[model samples]
Target chain A: MTQKDKSILMIGCFDTKEENFNFLRQCIVSHGESVIAMNTGIFGSTSLFPVELESDLVAAEAGESIGDLRKRADRGHAVEIMGKGAGKLVSRLLTERKIKAVIGMGGGGGTYISLAAMEPLPIGFPKLCISTLASKDVTRQVGMKDILLMPSVVDVAGLNRISRLIMRNAAAALTGMAKVNLKTDEKSLGTIAISMFGNTTACVNECTKLLEAKGYEVMAFHANGLGGNAMETLIREDCFVGILDITTTELA
Target chain B: MTQKDKSILMIGCFDTKEENFNFLRQCIVSHGESVIAMNTGIFGSTSLFPVELESDLVAAEAGESIGDLRKRADRGHAVEIMGKGAGKLVSRLLTERKIKAVIGMGGGGGTYISLAAMEPLPIGFPKLCISTLASKDVTRQVGMKDILLMPSVVDVAGLNRISRLIMRNAAAALTGMAKVNLKTDEKSLGTIAISMFGNTTACVNECTKLLEAKGYEVMAFHANGLGGNAMETLIREDCFVGILDITTTELA
Candidate 1:
């Protein structure tokens, strides 16, 4: 891949799921997209493909050496440190705008690291995680992020009939999202955030109609724990011009 | 409420949400359902209505006194202790068949305690959490439990136009679920668990069709994190007679 070409950031434990990631990379390439591979596997490296960012650097980012981590031989602790490292590194990559999107495939450890790596990306950044744990509750890991979790449908061990199809689809989806033009007119009077629930839906609808008529864009967030958290986070980031906290139930 | 009537277990911080809970209690009563209220509020008790289980008893369940917890003044610690107590108490109630369903409404602390308290309940058991955090990612707290989280479009502080409508709906829904007669035929060729993903949908569908034709019940689980965990959990409970595991991608 040339330096001038915008790339998809593919992160995973190359030491284990090398074949699956390779297949995913090929699928993306077949769709005329480039990939920047980052390894989060703590044990070792893979010979299948060239990795732009290795596990050593990831470990280093967590303020630990790969040798020390291996010497400790504590899987849980190691995974945690690696996840922190991956998150830090991914954040830097994001800040530099070196990648247009991010994708990862993993089982338990891999999924944890992949999610941690994508934590720094903003909402609608086209982050995808194809994992065995996809069907499991990942609310904590996903938080309020707009990360898309896809069920691998089978173990991402090797390229099989089922694995191949899923990986290809995941690749296609990522490439399509990365290449899409997301330009929208910022000509509205202002953006408003509204808290709403089923009971207040009618009220919110009326308010929204009037606000839109006045040339403002309105976003409604469910007063559920996650929805309220997201809205608050966005509001803190100064994304809203005004607030219509109709259903402040979350505060209770 | 009559002793002969199976009651809905209502859990919340009664000291804070007395009005809301009382309103909810009335709604349930209006629906011909009895409610057993349990308080998890640390500071004080409510005199508005009868509380079947008080915060002192809940705190005692965790091997601590409410006075000591109050003196400590650590909100997080108190919440954690109360949650554990509530969970233990709820588990005991379930074992004794004292309640048919569980419902709670709260903000952050209340939601946390309610979720923790309902942790010991089994899946298919009616459990509802009307919380501000409902819209938030609560996977970690919910784990593999089948808890229905309803977003409190407004805060649970007091009765308002939106809060009243939402709370009433919550109460009605809880009562309806508690009174539901869930009966299914246990007779079948056997139960089979199948893991599937979008890529392997066709194959799984064909297998399921053939299995039904053979008088066997086929259950499919998505290979995502949550889905895979739920399937494995149910399988461990000996809910299945055989396994298809077509899309075992979650294992990856």
Candidate 2:
């Protein structure tokens, strides 16, 4: 088995989600995985938990000072600068092969900013958002990325019965996704890629069975924006030996 | 005496600072001044206190669906749209005469977003930010508005001994600022306005003493960007009977 660093990149408005995030951090740490806290909140210095990448540093990454930012007192500018900074920081971390996954927590503004930060990461990297807006159509937040939106059934305000359960489960999901390893051997059939959606699921299922029976490996991609983007990205890397297009809804 | 509503507009990223905000709310409420919670956190809903303005509504006011904004997952855009929305919302509230004062708390993004919301309020509206960046120069955050910033000496993470004290004091400050009955009558001398900074403080102070001796109500305005802007704004409204131009650094 190859060595995989279970280092998770956790980002949030530490200026806001301190308690919830602290719980998540503790849960993750107890499970034997290290977490890197990238704070997006620049309110003050009395952070509830220790942060490796403070908002000021993130602001600096975007070519601004936290003091100047406070002076500018522009919310939209803060979001943009932090987003750009997070992207740059995330990109650098990816290049250095430091983080195995990404997870964020926030309501609307926090969700948007953190997810925007995650937008630049390569596909198949585990990305998750425990949001109050998760049950709602999150296509706007997920976009074309493989970001997993877990609905936080309760408000992420104070520590409560439901919030603790939801947060612990989320922490587990990220760690599990990051730690799981599925090794492929050389003797397996060459991989064949297929696109499918609910409307054409039966046809795609039949095609997959037929391909597998013919001694070829098959993998199905959903026709949603995120799935289509994933398929295209994987295809660019020659991750498939052949392609069978079953649904064109993502294009049309 | 003119009637001024004691309804204070309290805005912040409640997603994390629930305990602190709740404490402030209770303090404000107990003091008999109604506090309006203008929520800046768009995360989940387990808010410890009630908010009059939700971030989703703020986003909608910015001309974007919350769902679409979530999908776009753009932080900077979130900040801009929210800022614009807060500006409009605050302006409407001011027009309707709904709020008497503004109070905000958060680290970076929260402070910026909240201050941006306070930008449209006129001079002497009593704007404040309980911020982490308080010790640093906040000319940018305060802008030209009459916004007062109280430093959150601790991180506004949770209700520790220190955080509790700062937040309570901040709450009291807002309530006090809002409820003060500073009834001015017609017998006072004509108001004299002067602008000055450290380089001209001694000169301005000396002049103020002389003016007080001469029976004029002398008010000195610091020549910082915000102060200069405020001086200009107040001057525009015929606030000064006589202008003593002590410093022109804002113009420079």
Candidate 3:
């Protein structure tokens, strides 16, 4: 896609970390890419863009807000409701092709909300997260996607030397990725998709080899949910010609 | 845990269906107040002893049979490695606490090496599966802890009607949930663990008010990986005084 078509979508609880968001937004603009920062904070605060969409805009579009939908006594309900709103907003941007790449930074709550937004994007659409929980097992957070996780060495409590360094590097990374042309020839090879589990490896391998020798390229995926989902995604993209699902074990 | 303390663990490869494993063993035996079954099949088959201990000797293990593992390989060093040998075998099982629960089942591959060996057990352990992909989504397969998914429905290909029905029901409903009686004088309110997705209404309202009135307790799970892990299996074991978690978002 052209640079103009490659819009970088920056999302997170920017109200809590306006300084870092500002820095990242500047980097995106400087790299010759446009940005749409989706602010997921519950209460409004100053934003880099006056026209930035807030959670209320998301709720309004969805026809609900955290307070309106959640019980006053339950904070978790509010967070979950807000996360839904954010996910909807992000999903819209992705569907409309307004966002070619997405980046977010946050702690536990914000990470939860941001990931909710990122999860709906197609695989390999350039998803990145700079989070305090990056060092931990993020399989749950990143799921089966190609989301890049950058460890925020310091707590995201506020802007600091560490925050600046991390955000700058993240911004640079996404900017470069967004600017690059990743178009591959669509007619190079007809692909076959296969699913296998640890128990059924031998069967799939034998089948894959047989297929390869016949001049068919076989793409194998683990039968785990993400693995299956990834293969389906590629299939949906029309990247594969046929499917020899030998090890369809994990789907069970 | 020590090796002696370690038990023979069984996991299901419910990628296809669950008949063969569930019916292999029958009759539930009591080890103290808990009931245990030997077979891992969930819907089609019925087991005499539903729970098995790690110490007891059993015949088959999920990822053990080399012949079966070979059949499912696709390509790459990782695929070959995962298909054969026991690379992440121990850790993967340990992460799920298989030695602690030892639940498994499948078909040709499912029965050839998946559930037979899991037969011999000391007592007071977990083992279950209801393959046929076990009727769609399988949060139940993982349950609260130490369970494996076995693929038996589609390709494992063999079995009668009774076997399939028994296996499905067994996998979905069987808990292997050991009931332990404790003597306690101290009484605390109960806690509810709620799972929330961005889309539910009833969960958000009922959970909040209930927790406040009873002052019993409330914990909200985000319906993502961590949230599901925290609420469903971990916190449910009385980790907290009480639970009121109603919002379940990511089950789909």
Candidate 4:
């Protein structure tokens, strides 16, 4: 699917990452792509850019009011509140097929909010996070999602040369990943998803050859966590007609 | 309180990260700390170093056999199987106080296995992962746990200068962290936990001054996710007599 068909949802804490988000949006837009900005910043009501979904709207989506959040005003609580709001908003966008990819950039607070929003998207939807916490242990920020995190060499404090280079590269790469079209053969063949590994390589190869000979398509899943998770996601989407389970070791 | 009182639990896929783990073990040992090595590798039956807990034992802990896994031979499946096994083993060790820190070093498979083991650890226990995927998106590898990840700049294919430097730094840091003994004043003052943020800084400062005047020890939780989670954990462990939740933002 082309990115032109779907807008990239850029989520960030506008209060903290206003400059980063603006630069990132410009980068994405420069690549012939459109953007939908969400203000996930907890401390502010207004943003430098036109934020379509304000933090207050996001908070309301999470069953809270930004006004109430400000009244409370604890950084940790703000993160939780804004994170929930943004997450709910992103989930709704995913369901409505309005977004092809989600790009989030932030410091600790921004990273927490952005990643939380993108964590619920299924595989194949491009999810990218450019953050200060990119190099830190983000096991909780990513969970089991295919969220791609590009480490910002420096802190997301100012628009330094290093930060700009990293952010630019990440934006281009993600936009390319989101929009790239894979050429498909016009011929229709019933596709099959086959799970394989090095030990079972020969067996899978022979099966694939035999399947191809009979006008059937074969897709191999390496059985790694990413491969396994992706295969399941594709299967759930009804993208594959049959499955040849050669190795079920992960089940062990 | 002392490295002599606790041993770091070192877990890795011996088949993939045998050399790295062995080196890591040596570094920690050089710092006068001991290591409990668990081979979480799936491909091999033995390791380059003496592995205290074998992959067979780990698999069995997850209700499977390494022999069966070898015959089936799926790398992805092996990772999942060993991850579960290692996770179970590590959890038990943590509960039994057999380990003060869990150190895992590996490439993709090894990192996966090691991180899976360390994920179940609570807040206070020091958890570290030295991995090739350290710079990559490690959100899944770290989860919500307090695991620290050190990026091995180069691949863990050999004992190169870069890898050695990183491994050494990570080892020394973790050891120092583990062995640090904060000098006690021996003064009996009841401790209080205060959750604060920039917005509540003035209020918290006043409160801290008043509490200290009343001869109460006050510790402030900045109300970031880490700080808030830590405060909750310390509270759960009965580490505080009173809690001043001035900023309730995280509750949103």
Q: Quick one: best DockQ, which candidate?
A: 4
TM-score of 3: 0.46
Model 2: residues >4 Å from true position, as ranges?
A1-6, A63-65, A120-124, A182-216, A220-230, A236-238, A241-252, B1-252
**Model 3: residues >4 Å from true position, as ranges?**
A61-63, A66-73, A181-190, A197-199, A213-215, A223-241, A248-252, B1-252
Q: With candidate 3 superimposed using the best TM-score fit, by how many Å does residue B147's alpha carbon deviate from the native?
A: 32
The true-versus-predicted C-alpha distance at residue A36 of model 1, in Å, is 0.7
Q: Could you give candidate 4's fraction of true interface contacts?
A: 0.03
lDDT of each: 0.74, 0.67, 0.49, 0.69
For model 3 chain A, give the 10-residue run with minimal summed lDDT: A180-189
Computed on C-alphas against the true complex, the DockQ of each candidate is 0.03, 0.01, 0.02, 0.03
Question: lDDT of model 1 at residue B237?
Answer: 54
TM-score of chain B of each: 0.86, 0.74, 0.27, 0.72
Residue-pair clashes per prediction, in order, are: 37, 28, 100, 9
Which number leads on lDDT?
1
lDDT of 1 by residue, B58-108 (tens): 999999999999999999999999999999999888777678778888989
lDDT of 1 at B6: 68
| lDDT (tens digit, per residue) of candidate 3 on A1-252 | 443675777777766778777877886676677888777776664546643676677656556664574336455665566677777887777656677778888877777777777767654355667765553555565554445555454456545333454565566555544543233112223667778888888998899889889987676666766567656655665667798776666656
lDDT of 1 by residue, A1-252 (tens): 323366888999898788888888887788677788989888898888779999999999999999998899998888899889999988888667677778988988899888888877754455678776664566677665556555564466766434564565566556645654131111222478888888899999999889989977777777866678767766665667899998978878
**Candidates in descending DockQ order:** 4, 1, 3, 2
Model 2, position B211, has a per-residue lDDT of: 91
